[model samples]
Target: MKTRSCFILMGRAVLALALSFCPLITVQAVAAETASASALENSVVKVFSTLRGPDPYKPWSKAGPQEVTGSGVVIDGHRILTNAHVVGYASQVQIQANGAGDKIPATVLAISRGMDLALLKIDDDSFFDSHKPVPRANVLPDVRDAVLAYGYPTGGTSLSITKGIVSRIEFVRYNYPVSGLRIQIDAAINPGNSGGPVIAGDKMIGLAFAGALNMQNIGYIIPNEEIDLFLRDEASGTPHGKPAMFDTIQTLENPALRTFLKLGKNVEGAVVLAPFSKEADYPLKELDVITHIGDFPIDNQGMVKLNANSRVRFQYRVQQLAKNGLLPLTVVRNGASMKVSLPVSSSHPMLIPSLAGNYPSYFIFGPMVFSRATSEFMNVPNGNPQILYGMAFAGNPLMTRRGDKPDAQREELVVIASPFFPHKLMNGYSTRFFSVLYSVNGVPVRSLAHLVTLLRDQTDDLLTFRFEQRDAEAIVVPRKEMLAATESILTDNGIRSEASPDMLKIWNEKTPAGK
Candidate 1:
């Protein structure tokens, strides 16, 4: 304790000596920083949203209304910019200024769930009269630059400003299947800190969007580059998402890998384990190493130099350099070096897809309820890893077919969304909830719509359902009797809709000649 106190005293003495030598310069710098921070506080806002998130467990209806709070900041063009997650699926949204007593209602003018960005328009333009947009820095800030994170984070009613510095920056994943430039800071970004502004000097550098989970004194911000792209894309009426490559990749840092690829010693870039598309004419394929994105050379770690000290993943350059969804790349294939115009896309089809704040499509039969398998639904077993292991042991498609892309015949895996509804028809049946439907009767279940159609057009005496499991029993139901009792079951269960709108349309579609 004495040693630490002595060090602290020595530091204070050194500071006092420096202050005495240049008191005016020191005071002026401090005053300038303080004024800058104070000006930015007025622009920050508290965002309140009433969101109706999808209920994957009960696909028939949405979950209860949830009131969530986050932060936002006024940007250029009389718009309020915030994180997409802050207001995604929001039914109602309102914003309150730093010390304002009344809330101003706002509507989402544009939103990008992939990039986690949204632009809001307020009903009252007079709100901007008192709150002016803070000047934003055009360029990225350097590491170690002092920053002030302003927001109404949880545990406070008013705006909270936390002092920190730029820790690091990288091109990393934001939401699933989306990647962008993210800046990490040493500030304490709490729950409500999301969508707030991170100020440096006299301008705003980024918005605090997320915090590092399970870590202390670490938070992440969305830099101006991403926000600018979102703003420009939103202006086009139809939002064209940020382009990215979802191809399977791996770093080429191993000596054996280089020797196998016949790569030269000086060669540096990430090697492609598998290309995104399997088409014959696709530009990329297995063993093709990506050497450069546009003109920026990539390192073995799949990183491109952003500046003198900052390096981000080569994929980040795809968003900036891509033209008409074509990203220029330098590739080395079979010891031949050449340039390729890689066709990148903003979306990827997966067997189990992310819900993206949308409700899952569902179709409920006599007793069994089925819905499209989604990433959120699959994660329901997270509370018990043992259940996941059990599913894996039982050959659950949810565990096996994850990360797989859709094919011609099978586009999605349909799962038993919920346990059997209360009905005498469901009596004596074992629980088959969460099982992937393999087939119905004698036909393969291609999708939820297909399953509904098969059930609707059934003529057999018995309806047999097979699941994708090793130890599962075939569930047989009295076909005509089950269909007859569906209405009564719905009444007993109080289920208003027989199926989701899309599935209902397929159910009501005309049957073909031979069934």
Candidate 2:
């Protein structure tokens, strides 16, 4: 009986030892998985960009280089995901792997300015083999959920991952202050962290884009949906379509127009300052009041009030378009409400480009350069006297989020300028498009091509250019020396590229080959 009892005790002890060892083996497996992930992080890299100047013209200048730093995640063997603004205008770009020597050369694959997302491609892919592209989780994490932001920040060189929570997911512009989109997270993001990945539970929820300068611990991201859209656009060759533009708009400042709409008590509408080319097609007049956009009501200040109790007014119709691009509008004319289809155009009325394309074609005579009127170059103020009298129309909207004020003094629309103009018209030609130039001897000044053609054809000691400006001014430029004088003036003003119609012309082409 004693031998049997001893055998039972020995068997029970062996069973207990086996159970304990099983748990130890499981813990070791989990630790190994975590270590593997840490090793995969080496695939991520840091991107640095250096710009020569504010303009693209002097991109290779030796002046102090303006540097921008951002984070990038390896999406594939050779591709990285980042923010467009981080390297969009960069003249030179360098990418550094965690343990690599000199940075690698990188090129932009695609960019979505509205969404603030960009894709980059590198030459080699050997650095990432066992890596996996972070999966896009369908469900959005609620506010206050645990979140992680991975990137290379200011202090350290290698990958830095910070932990935080989702404070909110509101429709806010991720980069541009005037625009807004859906973003998540309460992570504290800084300058160098712009293009990093915002992860939740080992899944990519969004891409870090911007942070509020006035607020602490506040950052924004581009959600995974935007990333999907960008990838699809890359396959399609073109991204999302650009917003449609209208030509005329008006300020809501006049008391008569405001009182007619009963705006002071309960204001609602955008005022029709003047029409672009299409204004003649609508019943809108200079003083016509625009009360509602689609269903969004306007306030007395000519602003579309969104969440009025919150006191937020939007300047561009683009914001409304971004909210919902297709919507009807209600306009008030002579104290009567009339519904009209709202055309999408520039917020300023006078600058609407009657010319085709975003950039205008230019004609150059020796040094004298001329371009047609476009929405961007026009800076006319709202409610011009000519508009009120029904003799004039604006090419842009009346209100905008641009730096120029609605009350800015407008110059006349000049299309022609020449030294042979009557001295009286020449005095004010600089102020209007009436002084813009078209051609030198019918060379068809359609682009930089026309300019180059004319320069090569120059043999006459005295050259003449036919000029056309608004307000019925036609001028002829004579004497080749006068044209040379104009070139000197342009160079002194730091205007290097005469091809672009906009003042911010950076890209230039001296010949067709250069283009």
Candidate 3:
């Protein structure tokens, strides 16, 4: 009788407490929500970008304008952190504070194309004092922990905030040929939500970047660690973030390749099908089997299981090793384990000397095109044989072929096409042999930088091209002659007008101000 009475009394006490503070709990919740709303409005900034599109086939036509919208967080008084792709190839860029209508023009400060991170600075001085800078958190949270993403999503935005949990800490690839430490979140990251803050409590943990195209609620962010590295590299005046390539042995899937190398099932190693660059030749070989990179052993599946329970595949091993250019690796050949050093140099040799802001020379005097043969276009057979010269290294050429066994004894010439050519011309050309070019008219070619410089200096009545080719005489083609022929052919085929943009700069800078 006493125990039963005690239980009844305890239950009645709980009911009395719940009834007494129900209204008070509701009031506190409302107050807290109001405070959060005010903070979000003050923290988020709206990004405005001017995008451009051209006729894919025309080279002399102008481009049309488009608008891109996104969100950003001010991490420092002068600098804003965001994704590189958000503002890439943009013609104009500006930012708007929450509740403000005026757009403040912004200039890109620096960009890490390999990592997809960009730093921008708004020209307005008032922005520094108006927006409070959010502090970056050094320590990340554990899985299943709550986090908030603040951005101007597709929905009505005073600064839309979404809540989700940490899903994974993975070493996954974001874009092809670029991979690194990635934070996978269960947050809904959509079109306009990119470049926003992924915050925990009051601190920022990462920048929202990419998402799984086929999956729902699966998005990826570049961790604060990478952000910190970017800032550090900026301070030290070093190129941003980890290396882009690595030098390691590849484990081929072909059974005949394994048999040719005299390897058995008991062998635990990978074959070196190709080297990253010429520098890698000092330490790597065509048939060498790689056993390790640093202290991590590579399995037959080409997976390198790190000591920390995380795993990274060897597919991008060349890029990672190229981060420093002087990376060390361990390999096993014929049951012998040995250490080797590899050099991370430019894969394309002839283009390296000319890549530093110089344009190839070309002259348009009569009716012919003049340009030089580059290593870029000549390495392939039957692709762009018009301008190929030399056959010195006849076996395995570097970068001519994307993959396969090394042939160190092969050589080929490079070629280039005019920017104003018909887009249909590229349809049948499946290989890169026709792509290597330096100049159009008396202009020195480096990268595409020559194109912008040449276009701006276009004052000549005729454009002449001088190209290098093996066996065939170096020929000069005139611009007007080609144009007349092109016009006549197009008119006959009932086609008119071209889509190529003549005024646009083709350099890969994210913002127009970058040039």
Candidate 4:
């Protein structure tokens, strides 16, 4: 979707006509409206941030600095509330008051990248003395309720206010966090308007964040309920990334399937296809039908009512729980009804991680570069489809488990990142770049660190590296010759270090116990 950028320019002809018809308007009513708008404007401020993000392809390097501008509102606890994307990688932040010329320094105090919310603290306490925090509304505004969007959009140095109405409130996917539950409004959400407050009278109802690319005047806002959750999570002082259900569920809308599952007449629920986590205590099982999540009764479409007027996906109910809490679920398994307590926590680990935090992890031994498979890696051109499929289905218990060994379940996938230049040591070897590793010297590689340990602990004369594809032959290398060529390879390639800094740290910590 296209991000809204640049301020909207108003036509001079429309302005002239409005001025010409000004005599028809009541002076008292206009005065009261202006006064109310001015009061709300005081809480809004412009945010400027300088960011430097890491390069995904070259894990050892960092990208150039980038400058971004957005808007924020003063919230409770003397903090400024804005979008996480605005200050996520910010090295420096400055806040400009609505009508002030001076820009005060600020620091990010708490951030939730998943929720796209961040809280900032002003360096000087005096800023709060003049600007008051806007109170959040406890209840969501009704559809078509009049609202105002306050921010410093593009092309304007001063605060700009736009009048609009709440067009819709539903569970729409939020682009940043890749989650759902958003508010749609017709007010324009230009680039500079991000993080600004959506005001309904005196209370703040939402935060302007994203806009639709294919449609006009379609902007999105983070609803007050989600903002409340973000603030509460920060107040807890513990990082709980994001709460997840950890199960793949499907709607039980098919009457035939529902009947085959023995669901009672008029019963509504969703069927669990698989639980992502392999933990023994995981509550849900395949084919189990979830009838209720907490007090909300799920319908055949896998939706639950938020109130009498609104219903959203059942996952929303799970998102409301605090970390490490229990989500009570009512399920029907094999025609028997039972209550199950599912643990509420962040996403479980997979062979390939969905989100690679700031930098990816990698280790380079001679010309062979080994790195953990991640979503970023899969996006590279000419990636192996088989490896991608394995990563995608890594959550399946049967697929992840290797052979009959109890410890054969791999937690992560390590792959050959790229093809190394022709070398005497690797002669006659046809490398399969991006291929998943099978084992080294007959021992399974569970993680990237495990591979390091396996190589370090090897006592054989030659190392045997196997790939996942059966047709691919093993790569055999003489230990002594390979070790002698490592330094030459590094020097020829002008690599400052053999491995990334994080890998060096892991190697140091994993050094043999008494060595």
Query: Candidate 1 lDDT, tens digit per residue, 32-129?
Result: 97876666788899999999989988888888999999999998799999999999999999999988898889999888888899989997787788
Query: Which residue pairs of candidate 1 clash?
Result: none
Candidate 2 error regions (>4 Å): 1-26, 52-65, 174-180, 241-481, 484-515
Highest TM-score scorer: 1
Better of 1 and 2 by lDDT: 1
User: What value of lDDT does candidate 1 attain over all alpha carbons?
Assistant: 0.88
Candidate 2, 1-515: lDDT as tens digits: 89998999888889888887998998998888787557546656799987543211121122356788898877743578898777865678778876677788888887765567788887676645644465666665666778888787888787887788877655544332223445656678887888888888767788887778888888877767557656765778754433333434656767775666565545455666665343366545666677776667777665653332232333334434533344366777666777776544223333323222122454433334444344333333233555323223322222222233222222222232223222332444343232333455654354334444565445655444443322433334444455445455556646565444432232232322211
Question: Could you tell me the C-alpha RMSD of candidate 4 in Å?
Answer: 10.9
User: Against the unseen true structure, what C-alpha lDDT does each candidate score?
Assistant: 0.88, 0.57, 0.59, 0.77
Candidates in order, TM-scores: namely 0.91, 0.56, 0.61, 0.80
lDDT, candidate 3, 1-515, per-residue tens:
99999999999999999989999999998889787656655767878888653321222222477788888888775788888777765678898888887788998787765577888897776777767777778876667768888787766656777889988776666543356678778888887888889988767889898778989999888888778767776777856345544444566556787688777776655677765555534677667887766656677767775334445575445444544566567876665768986655433233312211122333211121223333222334335443322322322122344332223222222233333334332233332223434245755444333443453355454554433222222233433454445555445435443112221333222232311
TM-score of 4: 0.80
Candidate 4: 10-residue stretch with minimal lDDT:
1-10
Between candidates 3 and 4, the one scoring higher on TM-score is 4
Better of 1 and 4 by lDDT: 1
Model 1 lDDT-worst window of ten: 506-515
In model 1, state the lDDT of residue 326.
92
Off by over 4 Å in 4: 1-32, 99-102, 152-158, 172-180, 276-282, 320-324, 354-356, 381-408, 418-433, 459-461, 469-496, 509-515
